[model samples]
Target: MTDAILRVTGLHKSFGDHHVLKGIDFSVAAAERVAIIGGSGSGKSTFLRCLNFMELPSLGTVALDGREIGRPAGGDGARYYPEAELCAVRERVGMVFQQFNLFPHMTVLDNVMEGLVTVKGMKRAAARERAAAELEKVGLGAKFDAYPGRLSGGQQQRVAIARALAMEPEILLFDEPTSSLDPELVGEVLRVIRQLADEGRTMLLVTHELGFAYHFATKVIFLADGVFHEVGTPDEVLKQPRQERTRAFLARYTEFGF
Candidate 1:
């Protein structure tokens, strides 16, 4: 609320006959960590994807730093941006996915450096230095030369995080960042994310980790049926929700001891 760094208005997404997101109006302030929680098929991932222009919204306006990203390119108020513009948007808004998206053939350091060198056009030596520093921050400095296949799930995910951080993005998006990791490995990844939050990185995360969400988020949004069903501070939304739908969702998570 201090001054929205990212804003979405009238957001909507559809895949043929299936409509996922419906008129979601939301915003995030600088250095604010926003946690989005909901049941499966709640459009959490699509909502995150739309922010980075990874999935073009059927109708909406996504603005970053007060500048709207896509333009009206066709009829019916349909909008989209060119790849060049979307690429520019992504440089400022980085995203990490559920699965560890690493290059199996590249060394850990190289995997982190690849985007810097290829996308940002930095020199290989400079990119290597930057990537190594990011890996060190994520507790993976010793595994610089190791390949993705040789690393544990947590380590691979840390590498993924390091890759995203090496870009020095203004905002980060995490979509179920630890969902694919072994139960034991989830903590390691979450710890790294917590460190990022403590360092004051602006982030929006889609997660089912309710307990962590309770502590990690500055603002929590319970998204259901493609709309924001509840939005407030963590305690307001997670610990004391007024909406019955939000209560039922939390009850289900509580049933699982979340």
Candidate 2:
């Protein structure tokens, strides 16, 4: 028996002949904040996507809360889980993207209520109540009626986060959540994420913010060339990396004063 909330084994992903992820394996315990750090083309985003089957794995098993997801049948890579099963898996694993991915046509409240009402079969009154609370959690209660177009980049991103939180997911996957914002706007989004971290929300994040990662992540995995070159506490991997590749990668960030 394992206490891990999520377990990924022998994960591999390839686009034609170009292999992006090469036999990666890791398990995330409940409430663990894992930061996946690497230079460009290191498969960080791909690895994150595979967790929720957003990008199907070429080979691997993903188990959440003890049950396996999208169990590939046979040796062929063509078979996949039915849409219904995938939907169930996704409901427990929410994602926040680099781009705010909000619906411009809908008000912030409507955007957050979409998944709850449509996918979760929530009633309008119930979903609206939940959506309002989620928005408040992200400090956006006042923007409920505002459209995405009316909000600043940071505000829009908070809407995105609130939308995900409205689902009450077991784990949150963040793919460079602050990357699309202007420099001045990144702090607000980061502050919200920090609050979630402090509240012990299980999260897996791919980020370039070294300072944030160092301060926020409980575990840091330094990936290079499709595999984790170093995995340890943030202090161990970020401050004193064991592998040359990990050291070299952090050195670049150091030069930039990150």
Candidate 3:
């Protein structure tokens, strides 16, 4: 058995004739924080989505904890695991989207508890306890009864994070988690993520915050045109990139004093 917690090989995705991700391959080790960075239209989000099977790949293999997720049915098409297996995979691989994607009608606590109760079949009382603990982890315990509308963008996002955490997933995938927040609120959300990173939680984050990625990621991958242009430690990839494309891209950020 390999030490990799997640492994993706020959990943490819296309929208009709327009290909987005082109034969990508990568892996994440246990407790490793990997940050995927790239400009718009670079397939960063699509790559992250493919990991959890949110967007099915046109081709490739994705394995979590040594088990291959979707398998090839016949011909060139891929056959995803049955619903039961998929559900189990999803439960183990938690995802936090760019948007909060919370239920507006439910209170923060209910929103967090819903998955535990529904998917995990957890008792309401036990789910409530777990939900509250997760919310407290994100520093939102006091807002349990508050509706999403009553919370600030950062708070709502934290609720979403808590909801994912309540599942006790083995790995977390963050897709530009701070992109939609107001600049003032971005710091709060980043702090919560930073805390998770400090706790050695395995995470794969797609982010635009170069500084945060540099500080939080144990490894950094630079994606371009659906391929990994550079992959290395934060300092190696972000600061001393050897690839021309990677250097040019980082130069733009540096020019603006990022």
Candidate 4:
């Protein structure tokens, strides 16, 4: 098997008039922790969405473990991704959103178990067992029956993580995982991410936490004008960034807490 779990080549995306990604080329190895950081409109989130095929690329290819993730159907008429193929690819790539996208009508356990039963075809009892284990992994075993409306922002995010984990995905994508939390709650979420990294999970994160990026990231990439302008080891990119844009961005965070 190829060591690279994710391979994107010449990826491009545009939102009508705005070109979000301009020929992005990158590869992520198994169990690698890579952080993508940049200014608000640098296309970090869009790039992440493209990885999971939530936002299809205008021109490019994304492959996971040697399999092309999404492609158009050929003239023969059969869909290249027939619905099932797309679902399978999505299953292998679990994503945790900034809003924590939990179902308001379901309990924490139910939210986690729903996908397992519906997508993976697991029995209720087995799915619950697996869900419980995942909740426990995210320190949410006690909130299994609690509703999303009742939990704090941090706890809700933990449930989201557990929900994703229940599928046992090979790779995880975190889009601004801590951006929506209260100031004091960011640490709790970061702690969960840190634990996952310590356990050697393959993760791709888009975050503004420079401190965490400096400490946890195996590689740090800086985006500018819809492209990865700079990339290097964490220390090289975050601490002694060679690009002027990167240095200026860090300056604001350090001095004014932007």
Clashes of each: 0, 0, 0, 0
**Tens-digit lDDT string for candidate 1 (42-121):** 99999999999889999989998788887898688688688998999899899999997899999999999999999999
Task: For candidate 4, write residues 1-258 as lDDT tens digits.
Answer: 358988998888888999999999999998899999999999999999988878877777888877776565665322244567668878999999999999999999999999999999999999999999999988888988899999999999999999998899999999999999999999989999999999999999999998998888899999989999899999899888899998988888889654
User: Can you write out model 3's per-residue Cα lDDT over 75-193, one digit (the tens) per residue?
Assistant: 87556567777788889999998998999999999999999999999999999999999999999979999999999999999999999999999899999999999999999999999
Overall lDDT per candidate, in order of appearance: 0.93, 0.92, 0.91, 0.90
lDDT of 1: 0.93
Instruction: Record all residue pairs in model 4 with backbone atoms less than 3 Å apart, i.e. clashing.
Output: none
Q: Flag regions of model 2 displaced more than 4 Å.
A: 76-79
Please, what is the TM-score per model? 0.97, 0.97, 0.96, 0.94
Give lDDT: candidate 2, residue 83: 80
Clashes of 2: 0
- Cα-lDDT of candidate 3: 0.91
Clashing pairs in 2: none
- The CA lDDT at 118 in model 2 is 94
Minimum summed lDDT over a 10-residue window in model 3 is located at 76-85
TM-score of 1: 0.97
